[model samples]
Target: MSQLERADRILDTAQDLLLRWGYRRVTIDEIAKRAGVGKGTVYLHWRTRDELFLAVGAREAVAMIEAVAAAMRADPAEIALHAYMRRFFLEAMRRPVLRALFTRDTDTLDRFLSSPARQPLQGAKLLASREYLGALADHGLLREDLRPEDLDYSLPTIAFGFFAIEPLLPKELALGLEEKADQLADVLRRTYGPARPPSPARLAAAAPEVVEIFERLAREYGAVAYGTTKGGDPEHGS
Candidate 1:
């Protein structure tokens, strides 16, 4: 393989190991072994595992930014809105990997989410996200009083809950990640423009809708879904 391909191969392997094993359990040797490269080969790409893993996350982040932008091109307001949010939530579910990193590896998810580095990416995406919402707003797609920033925060924040809390709850309690995600997006759409109070049954029905969005995101974004191969849910969501 070419040097770039070799480097990318190493990154994919390393990310998987990190997800499955956490930072502490993962090792350079394992990544090299998984990548079909020698240990020295791994170092040529990055000096430390921290650097390698962080690079993996950075690449994923760039892809997701593009993915959300792409989702905006789809048709029908609610469907397109769902698609856009699926992209965001899918990325958010990956809080363990790309979304919030140092926090998981070093015990800092909340701290990192609240950090400054998130500001610009958060702000830039908001402009397009808000603009997209403006289109939805015009179509009478949303609830009629919500702000674009809610698009910036809500569903993803709930996804943050999945990444931070799911592993903690038993499988039954975890329910459906994507289902909950879609339901939340629906709420965001209706609530975004206006706060339409959903009845309990309506809220329940939205579950699978959210799950579909989550599944779509996982398929498109790959490893962004909190990358825990096992039970590595985030702290109980605030």
Candidate 2:
């Protein structure tokens, strides 16, 4: 098999083991065994167990970002702040690894939570960046009164609550994932969206820019996940 294909197979095996056994219990020996490669081969791809798991986390982040970008490309209306939040929430819910990262599931992630790799994976910061929010504001999708600083704090706090709160409620009382996502979209719309909707022309004009921002994020995360660069701002390869 090609080297790239072998690396992906190893990653696939590692991610499966991580989801099934959690980080604390999964080991390199098992990952190599399952991937049909020697333990040394796994090391060749990822020098340490922590790096391997971090790559898994980064890969999941890339998938979620790409999914959100895809939705925006397919529908210009999805470029609006509220629509983006809805799509992001649903995408996170659909990926167990990504969901764990968002919810801070320590049982699954443990010490990996504190890894520097976690920084770029925080989609909240990327999504709420001045550039991203400014684009929304320019398109009249964001409320005129909202500042970029306000979003930097509010978006992550609000998204965190949604990710962290669901598991705390009783199963019988908890809302389904789709319903919760809708509620999240509603809250974001009421809190950040303009009182008057932007025209379709504005949304269409904004789609390429909004989608490009997310696509860039995906590339950064993909670099970290695939070991093209060490952890830290993937843009500079730091």
Candidate 3:
């Protein structure tokens, strides 16, 4: 095996350990053993455990963003936006290390979450729905004066709350995942139209590109994760 491949293998092992075991308990010796390398070899790549952990954190972030994109792609027509969020949050919350990171990394999540203006790769995939809604207003498919930003915040805010907070709450108020997702979709229906709704055919046709972009993202995430393993700091001190 190449020297560089060995280094990444070690880092991947260390990262998985950190995520599963948390910072204090995970150790270099374990990482080395998992990587099938000597303790000295692990030291050669990262000077400290902290640096290795940070590298893992960065990897997880990239994987997450990539996963979010991919989920959009895999979603069926009716399930597009909701599927993306459900998958993103579901994938995100399952990882112990990531959940801790997301809870603590509020600023980072805010910078990326739903705000297409700031997040290009993610936003492009999401814009169609927003634009479709706006065009709905413009074309008189919906109310004329309902501002786009309000639409952006209103239903998504409810969806975000239910998706994010509802799971962690007690069973009495839990809403569960499916039920919560249904509620969010209902919020959209109510806000969009209790009476005359846009033709599903029209909205779906107008919004193809966004979902397609995300579909591409979902399909590419694993490959991207593998690629990161390739680009990471090469067998340092070699």
lDDT of 1 at 219: 47
lDDT per residue for candidate 3 within 9-113, as digits (tens), equals 976787676656655677788988888877766655555555555545545655665666555344324333344455656665665446655444343332222
Tell me the lDDT of model 3 at 20. Answer: 60
Q: Highest lDDT: which candidate? A: 2
Error of 2 at 112 (Å): 1.8
Error of 3 at 210 (Å): 1.0
CA lDDT of each prediction against the hidden true structure? 0.53, 0.80, 0.53
**Stretch of 10 with least lDDT, candidate 1:** 229-238
Give the best candidate by TM-score: 2
Q: Which stretches of candidate 3 lie over 4 Å from their true place?
A: 1-15, 24-33, 37-76, 79-148, 151-157, 163-168, 171-175, 192-200, 215-238
lDDT of 2 at 222: 76
Please write out the lDDT profile of model 1 over residues 17-112, one tens digit for every residue.
766766667789888888887877666656555656656665576566555544443322223455456556675565557644522434333333
The deviation in Å at residue 230 for candidate 2 is 12
List residue ranges in candidate 1 displaced over 4 A: 33-48, 59-83, 90-159, 170-174, 194-238
